[model samples]
Target chain A: MTTFAPGRKASSSRRHPRRGEELTFWIFLAPFFVGLLIFTLLPIAWSAVLSLFDAQATVYPTIFVGLRNYIDIVTDPDFLNSIGTFLVFTVFIVPVTLVCSLGLALLVNRLPHGAGFFRTVIFLPTACSYVVASLIWKLGLFNGLESSLANQVLALFGQQPIYSWLNQFPLFWILLVTVRLWLQIGFYMLLFSAALQRVPEQLYEAASIDGVRSSWRMFWSITWPQLRSTTSAVILLLMIAAFQAFDEFYNLVGAGPTARPPLVYLYNRAFTQQDFGHGSAGALVLTLIMVVVALLQNRFFGFGAADDDSPRKRASRKKVAA
Target chain B: MPGIGSTQISRRQMAGILGLGAVTPLVLAACSGPGASTGGGGSHPTLSQWYHQYGEAGTEQAAKKYAASYKDATVNVNWVAGDYASKLNTRLLAGSGVDVFENNAINIADARAGKYADMTSIIEPIKDQFSETALYNVQIDGKYWGIPMIIDPQAFYYNKAMFSDAGLEVPTTMEAFYECVAKLSSGGKKGIFLSNTDGGAGFSSTMAWATGTDIIASDNKTNGFSGDVDALAETYSWFRKIQQNGFGLQGQPSDWWDITPFANRKIGIQWGGMWSMPQAVKALGDDVGMFPMPPSGSNGTYALIGSNWNQQVAQKSPNRKAALEFAKWLWVDQKQDQEDWALSYGFHIPPLKAVAASASKLQSGAAKEFVDAFTKYGKATGPYYTNEIGQAMEDAGTNIIVKGADAKTQLAAAAKKIDASLATLQ
Candidate 1:
């Protein structure tokens, strides 16, 4: 009845466009939000709530025990022992892994030919699944003290090979550290290699012209300055990874008296003993330790030459000065 | 040139190429889930089974046979290759574990907290089929919490070649056992292969049973031997004697220690369970032979027998009755199938007396010697020691024998710890 102009129709089409945009926005975001809510967010929320109560393996009604789990775990000798074991593991693994991977990177960096092949070879262990590597170590190769490859190597000498390398203290510790070092070297090596490549050729050439013949001087003056961020990153990553060494110990060392990592100890408490509250408390403590360690490592060991203050740190100061 | 390029890039062409790459990753991840295999997951009822895949033929055959028989219900058997208890507990707590499984009694009793169905009524009708010990081992608090699927009775496997070479008879008395062990050792073959791993539960269980003082408490309602420290001390002293003699395997990783010396023909006497027999046969073939472990005093040969394989319906299972009915069919109706499965490998002993009788003839010669060890001298006890008491026995058994830990002090401490643990169970 009313004369509807063509321009009016076009203008009307633009009406309620905000609603259409909102619909499209939600449509695009729906899948991710649903998955996040279902998988990550819900479980995290449940774990936090459950951490406050006495939850057994079965879905029996939980009792609000009021921080009793945290207290018990702190006091328990077994949990304390596990903490000691984790400390030992970190002390042994962190420095060893960092040094070995760096050394391996440097070693391969000098290779004139087949550098890619050597890199691939070093990285091969990383590509093999942890579960598979653990099984291979447990069976076929290790076998027993008398027959294990290590024992056989010992047998070549005049020593009578002991039956159980895993039972003895320092030997067991060494074996575990070695296996871990083997598995982690490739991962850290790849990181160092990438960082080493990014290091400008000009820095090394400048150092070389200054008659810095020592490899040590070159590393400190040239290589290290460039790798500051990367090294800090690698250290933080390796520390976290070392603390999370569960699968290898779980599969290889087993739940025997000799070998139980902190994660394994926590797991045994939660599932084996059905003491979930205590287990969650242990996990929380572990998380706190990890966070603190990471922050400290970054703050102190972060890339630097002590000679001059970085402009970045000074800029924050300059803002306050202004 | 621009016109031609625009014409070539048709709407459908652009959409098709873009869509293919985007969808490929999603498709790949979907295919990576358990259901990707033709064997796993569907609308069909999946009967989840937990099994240890230590040996090749023993485990794989069982899986194939179970899958073949149960066409209507899909048998989803997850064979764990690591520490059986740890993995089983993880899956159970995750609330997505096997519907039916097997483990040692101590592990099962602990698992009864929430993971299993109250199978007291289910096992009532079929109670007479098993021996009293078998029945008792599976019962927790008057309820049949687990079905005794396989009886793992520890025994002494002797390499007939080595025994004959040493010209020693299977020992009957403690003194005689020592003499034979010494002779076997002097002949260059190791005297005994004693696995002291898993807190040496295997060796300690056999020794505790032989001494007539239960290594673990026999009742879940109370502590070890009702606070009988004297009895616990006596048993500890006896183990110390065994440890001092040539009868100890140094504490090592269990599986490797159990198999290596026995397989290499370096040991004449290997103490292990029925599960080890098939492995021995596979490694040494017909050359291997087995007998009941030597008796400790007049207590006679104390063979440690416990339920290895058992299944329970999930209380939360939607098809609870159907799931239980499947278990019954697998265990009771197919008792012969179980016997045949065991006989095929030449080691496993069936729980059913009828099946045992039928298989007895097939298991003659050295096999008879091993079966006799279980049949004649075997004794099973329920509510076996858990936690501290169990740890105490292991400490006394291995530490005293191998590491020279004082028998008296360690044993006394063990008894006290066990008494405390039992109090909680009560």
Candidate 2:
């Protein structure tokens, strides 16, 4: 009988990976590390270098102008408008998406059968590309009062079609918000659904026997407290996504006259207008703002957090389960 | 569904994983060398040529035929359909753009950066073969940047049926044109379908052509566009008058109106371009006819004729000989292509005088009349027409038409910018 002791030569031999194992680990990690450096770190470094120059299109030679590009970006009215648009988008979309997703998860959880099928149906929109969705919304679903499906239904009731819904102010924001909600609610619902399943079934049964008959009472006492971590994570993810609303606006309204998100505007300044320096400066400012928002959300909400788990919390959870 | 025996990913781990997966390859590719457009049979020294979506299948066929005729050379033509400038600029910046490509005057300033080759010798010999106005567009700062391939003059098109219904003859003068507008609008029909958004700038182009305006008089460094301002104000006054008279800014606006409304018989006359006629022929089905805008005061100033795409070689091209060879062949050797492009979709007037007279089929009688009018009475813009000053004036003029911004205010602002831009040019 071979007993493997902790420090025994045979046990140590079994514990340490062979040279082949070490090589295999690096081989597996090589692809991912290379990708990170190329796509994220390198472009970031290049952009930082570009931000100081006056990089016009192939015409004017690019010259390093120190913080002039940054000054221009901060002072530009167009930049301010983009920030305002992003704030409005974030303020409305984050809470709305969260509540709707939570509500949907609870609804589907109560369903007696075919929960998996319903979950798939709800989550389907998230899988579709933003460009595809925006196109459908632009040409087919919200084209105009006369041609759109929504307007056609509205017309049946003798009401004017909501033509130019995206053209008008505030309404355009609401429309964008609605489209985003349609896309993301399903994914978050699935997340909360899984979290709800993890919540011990016995506690809910006890609460029921104790005459906690009201749905709100049950949710407040049981579901809400349990979903705190998940809700925090989902909200934080949503806030980050909202800041990067370029694909939707870029496809729909284009960078023509009206629809100019910060990223789109940055792209236009850098590429279209051939002002690479300005474009780089704009990109950095936008990056800083987004990173700050993400950090703040992470700190306050404890979303995407590794420190969420602790011995005390684990003990309490086990006791609650028991 | 997410937590069902699934592992939780740490943020740092996720970042490291994604960074390795996504960023590394792209950075490496950028750092290496220019990515070529096509890899094919190496029987010939293949050069990549970029074109726009404007020309249809006939243009492509013509280009291919030209490439096939070349000995020890093959040209691979890439057609860009949308977001062209952005893509081209990206390739240019990355040091990986095509050998020869077509771009418009609007983007010429950028194309002339240290990236494009000076084609003074190649273009100088062929310059006299082109309309003086067409030749002017290819030159930037006393150097030939490109070879002009086609001339597209913005013109006016009217439905023959709509005109007959209104019992109106085609207007012969600017005054007569406005009178026709009044007659057309009285019977619940729009006089024009102009979108203020695009029309403001578009209208300014032809207006400058008609007014004989020397938009900018540049003597090396000192820039002048005071004359352009006077002409712009006069042109905006005309458009404002038309709008205020209950034309009702309705339907798809701007120059795109040459077909949409005219096809539906919703409007009698549309201010558009020679390129617009073919689409009109398709939509209205053989009843379409066009004429140059009536003279402002009968001094022979009519429509502003200009070229759309010009071909230039990259100065930084390691294969300079290959790039210029490809460019010269694209514009000159492809004479059949030049003719076919000139004739395609009724949109082009060939830069080659021979193609216009021989190969192009301008069947409409009104078109023939305008052809004669150009031969006898047309006035091409001067060399100053293609300068930084001209562009600034155009920008100023466009703002007035679109925004109804005070022409004097906008024009003056345009002058200052023009002056600043000119100072840098020298």
Best by lDDT: 2
TM-score of 1: 0.77
For residue A33, give model 1's deviation from the true position in Å.
5.0
Candidate 1 docking quality: incorrect, acceptable, medium or high:
incorrect
Candidate number achieving the greatest DockQ relative to the actual structure: 1
How much is the TM-score of the A chain of model 1? 0.83
* Tens digits of lDDT, candidate 1, B312-341: 555444445556767777777787677766
Over A110-147, each residue of candidate 1 has an lDDT whose tens digit, in order, gives 89998899999999888777777766666535555566
Taking chain A by itself, what TM-score does each prediction score?
0.83, 0.86
Q: Give the least accurate 10-residue stretch of model 1 chain B, judged by summed lDDT.
A: B32-41
User: Candidate 2, after superposition: displacement of residue B267 in Å?
Assistant: 5.0
Alpha carbon lDDT of each predicted model: 0.64, 0.67
